[model samples]
Target: MTNKLKLYFKAAQSAKIGIWEINLETNLIYWDSVTRCIHEVSEEFIPTTKNTIDFYSIDKNRDEIELLIERAIVEGTPFNKTFQITTAKNNIKYVEGICQIEFLNKKPIRLLGTFQDITKEQNLINELQQSVEKFSSIFSSANDAIFIIDISNGIITNCNPRASELTEYDNSELVGIHNSELFPVKYRKEVRVFLKSHLTKDNYIVNETYIKTKSGLTIPVEVASGKKFKVGDQTFSVCFFRDISERRNVEENMNMLSLAASETTDTIVIANPKGKAVWANNAYLKLTGFNLQEILGEKAGYLSKGPETDKRTTDKIRKAIQDKQSIKVTILNYNKQKEKYWFELNITPIFDNNNNCINFVGVGRDVTARKEKEFELRGLLEVTSHQNNKLFNFAHIVSHNIRSHASNLSMVVDVIENTENTAEKLSYFELFKEGTEKLSETIEYLNEIITIQKNTNIEKKEIRLKDEIEKTKYALSLSIKESQISIIDTIPEDLTVCVIPAYLDSILLNLFTNAIKYRHPERKAILKIGYEIDESYTIITFKDNGLGIDLEKNGHKIFGMYKTFHGNDDARGIGLFITKNQLEAMDGKIEVESKVGMGSIFKIYLNEK
Candidate 1:
């Protein structure tokens, strides 16, 4: 071979192109050094036509190359094709085969071709195709609006489906349109300037702007833009935008609700169904004298109930909340200063769409003054009812006692008129006189009762209960001596009770007289008097070992007028009644305990004036 020809052949081999030939007559193949290297065979190895064909892929590759060679030989035509082959070492590669047939006398004998390794080029093409497919997938499925723009002209090259959706435009209409078409008129100039500055830096840039939809409605949006890449002389950028109208609206509504809650005057609390407070408004803090930090996650009732709070009302509130029902109650509560107050509380159960109790809303108003007024009104009503009953009893006494006395006097006077004997007439006149005297006594008793019912200003004075007992014992000394009663005064000398002087004297005198009058016939009468102070009240007690009355049968009537028990000869049932009236008139109370045979105790509670 010539040197230049050898140099040319060496250059082709350096380029990784291998020359191959087949001799039809010998049915053999010839391969250059490059060909043997390409096949990964031994350097000195000679190959047969069949083995050389096996170097191609098993089925389609081998058959196609063989048919191409046959056509080049038989038709005397040249052909070039790219096909795959598996080398002797099991490495698969793509190679281009260009074949030509050499003929003598127009009869085909030899085929020649060159095999070039095109594996790297084919791999790069495959990688580019995969990258395109990945880009296509992401562009179509992104949630945010995406745009590909030519930075030089501000023209849109492509837009994703989401971009079209946000702009209310079709995908076909969006492509090839200027980016300014999507921007509001006022923002178009700013957007252009922003794009220009950002393209130079090629760094990510985020800006907020308003966009005009296809229907011309302006919507706020956030744009995240950056230069994605450069292709040849063209610089491309990508922008992602999302509409922020809904998020802004939510923030605005939340601000308004927070403002209202902070400024409302009613005490409000939001709590879980377990009664733990989740939120408390400013009014709640003022009402309860506690801050939100102190009460949060604590039981709502912790601040609402104190020593004087009604337990029954608290239990009802809890049950109502647990059952997801609304309840309204007025209960006494205390503040940080430990002052008593009343509140009208309204608790409403808050439920979700699933009908599950999620929380409770409690609203409270201060009703302390109103409650106090109601208490006073109730006391007045009770006093009026008591007075009415007393008046009715007075009428009954007038109709029964006074009429009987008057009828007796008229009958006696008629007898006096019909009698002829002076003794009988004088006896009738005496009967008339006795009936008038009894009538006068009844009238005087009625007058005393009427006086007791009137709201007179009785002056109160600090008087020793023991001194009062001594005075009463002196006044009833004759009765006491006649009954041979024993008096025992256990009252403390220093203990003083506030009472009207006359009422106190009358009360003690009546008690001593009753004890002597009702003395047991079997035992000597003994009276024990005692006094003590309990909180704001001074208690005076009179206990006597006497003919005890049965309280079970006559307890309600013990203090009633004209009501008698034990059928005692001197039992007018008026002294005890009058005694009760005087004590109550001085804003004091009287109670009694007695048994048929065991004796009786009368207890009086007087205020400390």
Candidate 2:
């Protein structure tokens, strides 16, 4: 081939175009290497007129191209057209065909054309058309009022049908109006500022404002201004407007309710479903003496608890909140001043549309005076019960001790009378003196117990448990050392218990002395002291490796007045009884485990159950 022919071939290849020719007179066809490659056929394969037409993917394309080629051959016409062709590999492609008829002596001799692959260009054009159609559909059918604005002039260049409905204006009238005209007079300036700030941004800007309709009514609206872009040298912004009048009305109602709550004297608190406080009314803030910052994010009922708050009441409130239920409780609470108050509270759960707990509302009022009166009456009742118990003990002592003393005196007098001896009579007087002295001591002990039990208004003071234990150990240092006993103090240093100080001291002294007095003779004594705390009580254990009581026989009588298990001469048997009574007086409890030879374990409940 000449250099010129090679240059033309190179140009066609660069353009992705192939050359083809057909001899009309001979009905033969020629395909260049590029054309053969386009058909996905081997270079050695030759094509003919009949076989070439088979490459047309559809009958319409085959007939259209055939007509074009016939017209070109018969009338010496030229044509350019785009059609689909299936290659030898059965793959479809769009190709542009340009053909020109070559003439010999005014009769058509051949047909030549360039076939260019236009598949990529056709695909791009189809995609662009689809995007435009989708955008048009959304713009015309959207629920929100849509508007296109000319950014340079703030004019409403175009708007959806919904915009006309929202403004109660004709479409023709709305297209030329200033964008700010849609907003009320009071909000137009602000809307303009929002629009200016938004149009330069890369994202949509949202805000709340009021719009003025053609009917002269102002309605609340939430608007979002879409990003701005240039179209045909004019920068435009698309904006959405939504009617929010109903939402505004709901918000206004909520504000009115809030105002009412803030003014009420009853305490009101609002918390999340998790029990964390979100808001508290003025009365609640005054009652707790906590600022918003101090309580926000904290559990609603937690801040007012103190040394005297009943754990049962608090637990009831907590479980109610966790279960998404409502509860009513009258509980004692302490303010920031550590001053006591009684609150009658009602907590209700707020649920969402899905039946899920979204918030909790608590309302309460101070009932301190009524509560104080009730406590006084309850205290009196408790005192009377203790007095009755004391009277029962007194009666038992009288029946058991006084009768024995009376019978012994009678026997002694009889002895004196029968003997008729002055020395014998004088000795009998000594026995009388001993009997009367024993009765007097019993009366004194009973009087002491009566006084202790009658003080029903015993104030419980918070005391560090480990410190009190150490103090008791120090007071009994000599006895502990003499007993040669091992002491294991395992109570945590920071543990605290609230109880009457004197009662606590007495109970500790009794337990310690009792342990030392009953030490086993055959083995070294070991006392392990430790404690465990639960939701409402602290259990302290005193485990002793010593002579254990026979619980099977003496268990019922262990804590009874004047009851003794072992035959120790000095065992008055009142220590355990007094210990039990002291614990009861302070709303505490005690339990014991013992065996004949193993050891003893005493578990004392330091706080109320």
Candidate 3:
């Protein structure tokens, strides 16, 4: 071989691209350097027709390449192909081969071809194609409806199976149709305006709109639209739509049910899980004297009087909402007018699809009239019991007073009849006269109780609470000092209570004496007087750090006649009962809370005038 040919061969071997030539007349072939290397042949190996054919891939590839080569040589055709080739090393490689027939005067002379390895490039292209196919499949198979629309005409160009099913139309029927056709006539114009705004603004938006189906039924639909670029010069809009008809129907049904419940005398309110009112029915508005718009978004406790309402009832409501359960409670509620009323509230927690608490629904009914009847019955029973107790006590007093006087008279008369001395008779008669006077005083005391029952109304006037406390303290200075008591006046100077002067003085005097008499021996007594003014009433709290009474055991009889907690000889037991009656006569009330060792607090609620 010449030096130039040897250099060409060396260069071709380094290039790794196969080079070949074929004689058109004899159908003989030749392979240079890399071609021989591809066949795994030694430099000295002879190039032959059979060996070259063995390098072509087996089966169809080999036959296909052979036919192309024959056509290039016989018909002066040019051929280019990429095919798999198996080498002697048992390795497969992808190769691209191109051949052109050299022609002179329309007759073929020889064929020239080149082969290059394209395995890596072809494999990369195949992988990328597979990834695209996978993504396309997922997009088309998703449950949510998807659509591609023409922005200019609002025509639906493409849609997935879900979209077709949702609209009740096949792809052939829906394609090329105006998007406005899917909306009801009333909403079609609105939909057009929305689309125009979205397209003009080039902004993505999520919205809910009504869609009319092929069956002529309107349904709620949620749509998300964005701009997507196509290969064309103009941009196309892509919109994703989902049928939310079922969800909307459920919500409407719930609202209807709530309205139905509210129409009855029962009040109904729906609140979010945080206990904020979301919806208040008409009945609830009427019962609370608050409009739905005013109460919505406010806390559920906004209608409650914090001091009068039972804290445990509020706590139970919170717990039920947190635990996603139902709770029923009877609680005191105040209306917009600040009038106190009682209600039986049934609260139920509403849950979402995931079993999480989403909201709370409360159904309530006013039990104020029923509670008032109960209170009246209780008052009647108390009055009857008091009357029975008064009668029994009166019997003892009558026997003690009347019998003593009568017996004295009888003894004096007998002494006068049997005695000879006038002076002894006159002394006995004076004693009998004194006994008659005592009897008259006892009869007057009984008449006082009857007068209280018949006429309880008393004129009221505004009296300063602090001044009343100070006056009572001054009046009982000696008793207060003897008890070693400390008085803390937390009541505001301007705080005033409405009561008659005489009744107020009597009430204060009775409470002061009781406090001093029951002062705990182990510690100095501390009395706290405070007052709070509410919208409709003034509450005065008189708390004493003294020996407290057992409320549970003695609360029923605490304000009854002849009921006494302390065993003091001076405790007439009628003081508290009379004080309570006096306060009641002026349309006021008293409530007490106490612990055996902690202390006792008495709250007086009087109407604000």
Superposed model 2: Cα runs more than 4 Å off? 1-6, 38-41, 44-94, 103-109, 193-204, 265-280, 283-609
Question: Model 2 lDDT vs. the true structure?
Answer: 0.82
lDDT (10s digit) by residue, model 2, range 220-297: 899998878898899999999999876676467557868989999999998888999988898998998888888999
Winning model by TM-score? 2
Poorest lDDT segment (10 consecutive residues) of candidate 2: 396-405
lDDT of 3: 0.76
Cα lDDT for residue 61, candidate 2: 97
Cα deviation of 224 in candidate 2 (Å)? Answer: 3.3
lDDT of 3 at 503: 52
Off by over 4 Å in 1: 1-5, 58-60, 260-609
Leading candidate by lDDT: 2
TM-score of each: 0.44, 0.48, 0.40
* Alpha carbon deviation, residue 187, candidate 1 (Å): 2.6
